[model samples]
Target: MKKLLFAALAVFAFSFSNAQDEGGSATSQGTWLIEANTGNAMVGSTAFTFTSQDGESVYNLGLDGGYFISDDLAVRVGLGFGGDSAADTNIFSYRLGAKYYLGGEFPIGVDLTGASIKDAQENPLWLGLQGGYAWFITDHIAIEPGLRYNLSLNEDFTDEGVFQFNIGFTLFL
Candidate 1:
């Protein structure tokens, strides 16, 4: 997973550098993005070993709106729903970040996110940080890959730490 994330970052880096050399604009400013992600969530501790969930895929359908603060910088916010087999979680994720446009038409950004996931039984909130890169293959389509590290704040699950690797396509409208 780390290797794949690095490779994706390399590709995005190359594309972004090339695009910048050719002079790209903030045309994608105010653009709306819809994305989906699938990955696993691990829960365990040294004292108590919890059974790991298999094929624990999470589907995130989100809408992001971007506002360009500068040619190479933007602020974005997204809201989405995340769910797995055992629970359906509703998440409100807020990111305050900036984007740096790479040469071709691609962009990379890092975000500090606070997310709250609620289910019928418990509500767990997490504070996480993520870095992502988007490779724009076309004006309307892009491939996005990201890495997230989250620490749970719930007392019962305080020891649980999650690392997620995600790759998905984003459609701009």
Candidate 2:
């Protein structure tokens, strides 16, 4: 986990060297992108928990790939796993969704995803919504900080929702 985080930071840092405007922003049409998030994942009280090596609870990391169908609309899919954490409920997740970028220089986006995780203990079915904004470091890249609210739709779990904070960068091509 630490190594991956370091490598991601290294890449982001080094990407600034000799980078010119790639002319792609969140609101740009027909653009493809890849992104990653490695920050705090705050599990809510009603959330299923994973215990780290230090016996602390945390959520997994996420990676996503997306394409802008139009200047304001994009479709994406993502995966979340490998926190080096152990839990009664192991959640290796897969999610598919779309985001619509609101009007701005660096647009704020609203997203809705249907998420499913592999839970060894029970049925693993869920969905999530996220609200975020992009702060462009370069025309081709941005640092995004976002909040997510996820709820378990399965009957075995409570109806309460979980919130997580994510920080990551997007690379446009």
Lowest lDDT 10-residue stretch of candidate 2? 41-50
Summarize candidate 1's per-residue lDDT along 1-173 as a digit string, tens digits.
54675466456444543332233333345543444344443321101011235755544444455665555556666555544545544444444455555652545655544455664445545555556777776655566677767667665546576787766555544
- Scored by lDDT, model 1 comes in at 0.50
Candidate 1 wrong stretches, greater than 4 Å: 1-36, 39-60, 83-97, 102-107, 112-122, 151-157
Model 2 vs. true fold: TM: 0.69
- For residue 99, model 2's alpha carbon misses the true position, in angstroms, by 1.4
TM-score per model over all chains:
0.51, 0.69
- The 10-residue segment of model 1 with minimum total lDDT is 43-52
Q: What lDDT score goes with residue 59 in model 2?
A: 62
Question: Which lDDT tens digits does candidate 2 get at residues 1-173?
Answer: 56766576658645752354555554578877677765444321212223455775556656777888888677877766633344544445565777666763333443433333345445445566777788777666777777776666665645666677766567766
Instruction: Compare the candidates by TM-score and give the number of the best one.
Output: 2
Q: lDDT of each structure? A: 0.50, 0.59
